[model samples]
Target chain A: MAVLLALVVAVMLVGGGIFTLLAAVGVVRLPDVYTRMHAASKAGTVGSGLMLIAAGLHAFDFAILARAFAGFVFFILTAPVAAHLVAKAAHHAGYRLSRHATCDEMRDHTKK
Target chain B: MAAIVTGLIFAIVWAAVTGSLSPLNLVLGFLLGLFALWIIRRDFAGTRTVVRPWKLLSLLILFVKELALSAWRVAVLVASPKMDLKPGIFAFPLKVDRDIEITLLANMITLTPGTLSVDVSDDRRFLYVHALDCSDPTAVRRDIADGFERKILEALR
Candidate 1:
């Protein structure tokens, strides 16, 4: 049982670490603010959530589980909304998509 | 009010399962009790988050698939000798109006391969999303409507 629990924790930790790394790579590699925000918000939250789950699983203690869970909930709630705000602000500030970008409805105001 | 009810339920369940209300157990119960209440009341009072676990599982699988697929696509686009990309902002008309529903749709779209949820209109009638490739706006809108929003409605309702 202990071995199984350890394995589960290990997997969750590794997976979360990998996804967080992927999100970081995406942030560096992606062309523009919007895309980078995609990496930051989506992968970032999932990665953090996974790590918190691992923490919760690794320790059966209630205090640890409670703290981990609180963090998880906070992350899940705040990250996406923050991303949306950043994207919205970027749009209003006229952050154009990359050179290859094909549309800018905000610029034309036609999308409104 | 709902949270109180949920917390009490969690406390009773914890006590029952452990067969002892020791101090540690009580503390654990209290801690988890709050969490349980929060989760239980987060979406709706007197209602549940989603109706079906199987449906949520399907959604999770689909989401993971989309995540991997999109991440790969974006990575390939970035790694290619020449970048072939067409990005744009498009207004995805909102059919899901509830705050939670809209939030779910937006996050799902953002996490998927090539999109980001930017904002919703003042009236909550339109969700403005930025797509990494807006070459086919119609196709994009159709995909979102058929893909994320459809499943959200299915599980949520």
Candidate 2:
């Protein structure tokens, strides 16, 4: 049982670490701020979630597990909202995406 | 009724797990549970209901999907040059009325990279958020309203 638990924890750590590395890359390489926001919001949340889960499993305590689960829940609840706020801030600051971009929803709303 | 039940269950679980039901620890647990109940009561306005299993399953799936997509995007971004950032703030109209719901929304916004919830309007209708990279303000607003807002509405409502 201990060995099995260890393996699970290892897998989670590796997965989360890889995801974090990918997120860092995306933050640097994405064509625009919005895309980068996408990278950060998604990767960061998952990586953190996985890490927490691993910790919970390793601790082998219900309270720790519950707390970890709660943290994961919190991450899911907030990540997208944070990303949207960042994107909105960038747009208001006059950040422009490539001309290939298609829609502009906030602008239309403001016109009304 | 719920509080008493929860407290009783928690006490039993705590005692069983720790093997020490010292008076001090028992009192502490009760106090913590009371605090949790109080906070929940304040935010939910006395409306209490059992959580639906299906909702929890769906939420878990949604979170996984969002995580994978975001990870891929971040990988690409970090590999690029010119590091051009367009940061600014925009007011977001909120549909959630419950204090817990709103707080959850605010925390969610803050957790996502490159964004932060700055302020809430006096009337509580709009939230001002700052974005690290704002490619399109309107798109951002719509995404928040549709994505997070929609999910939160479903979960909390």
Best by TM-score: 1
* lDDT minimum window of 10 residues, candidate 1 chain B: B42-51
Work out candidate 1's RMSD over C-alphas: 5.5
- Which candidate should be chosen as best, given DockQ against the real structure? 1
lDDT of 1 by residue, B1-157 (tens): 5466657667756765565657788668867999766665645664455456688779878987886576556555554566566778888889888877898898778768778888787888878888878999999999999988988888888
Output DockQ, candidate 1. 0.37
Pick out the ten consecutive residues of candidate 2 chain B with the lowest summed lDDT.
Answer: B67-76
lDDT of each: 0.77, 0.67
Q: Can you write out model 1's per-residue Cα lDDT over A1-112, one digit (the tens) per residue?
A: 9999899999989878877787788788778888788677767677778899798878877656666766776676687678888888887787778877787765555434
Runs in model 1 deviating more than 4 A are: A1-4, A60-63, A66-70, A110-112, B1-84, B155-157
Cα deviation of B136 in candidate 1 (Å)? 2.6
